[model samples]
Target: MAGDTPRAQPPPPDPDPGGHHPHLLFWRWRRNPLRRRTDRLHAWIALGLLLAVPAVAAAAMLAVGDTAYRHYRSAAEHEARTRDHRAAVLVHDAPRHPEPGSDEAKKARYPVEVRFPGPGGETRTGKTDVEPGLPADSTVLVWVDSAGEITDPPLTAEQIRSRTMGWAILAFLGVAVMGLAAHGITGLVLQRRNLAGWEAAWAVTAPRWCRLP
Candidate 1:
């Protein structure tokens, strides 16, 4: 019974190429005595960039979109509030101009002379754009400032969202371009290191092979 001690287990087989060789995702990270220092370093950097590129791109998209939304919202809100909209009557028939790709396949815009009441109830006249085929005496909403100068309407919520998204898309593409460039540069460096390692090993072993014959 005293001699019944458990037998010492044989050391586990080396995970090297001799056995069931599993294809590793990052072979350089695996424990191998022959792996060169620079080779290992390059592998680590490659892995880092693979993980970091997408993360940075997503972050840039969010950051850029948020910044653009804030700026556009502020400017649009101020402009919308400062601008005035009034009901105006057409004084003369709208000018007809044919437009390409319009649903009607013709003029989409008509430059009409419009008349509207000022703050003091006096009639004011100006040239404004309207839908084609509108006759004189038709009513339309006119956008203007306090000084009676015509201006564009404020940005709607949908428009703000679209503008922000567009800018974010551009930023995402830019990030992707930069990431690809970094990846390409790193790959070239890794190739150079690999070739240098091969040359060094060959230099040491070539003389030994010559002595064998």
Candidate 2:
């Protein structure tokens, strides 16, 4: 029995059954009979999206942010030019009611009548919201336009900056969402095509491999 040669052992099982290393990037671009045209197209699409999404998002954010900042700053400057702060005296006591100590309550205002000097040096009376519980004849500062009408204070530099940042963030998020959606849709279409191709190839080869009588 010792005279017979031992049978040769089969080669060890391949760690990567597909013959492609797991660490390899862009393996679909490699020349292989198993790789299909759709595989290359999918790889190219993924590569383009990887490089394009961030660039497009940054551009959109900058463009929208610049436009918003300019518009807000111009409006604020115009308001500052046409409006002025003047001392006003309350005509009647401001009505007060009990409220919780919350941010909403802190910012709450009540309507009260006040008299202030007009642009022509004459006294003008108007209704405006002010802190509650103020006694009659209390002096307060109010913003008035050229026509002596009570108006809101002009936007500050901080407000303009915040508005610009908000718009920029929105633009960035919008572009990111669109890019992700496009990539997902393309992946689905390519996957379907790949499945169809595999099924057709298998249909042609199955009969040859299984020879019927």
The most accurate candidate by TM-score is 2
Model 2 alpha-carbon drift over 4 Å, by segment: 1-35, 97-108, 117-126, 202-212
Q: All models: lDDT?
A: 0.76, 0.83
Q: Lowest lDDT 10-mer window, candidate 1?
A: 5-14
Clashing pairs in 2: none
Task: Give the Å error, residue 212, model 1.
Answer: 16
Per-candidate TM equals 0.64, 0.71
lDDT of 2 at 205: 62
Q: In candidate 2, residue 50 scores what lDDT?
A: 76
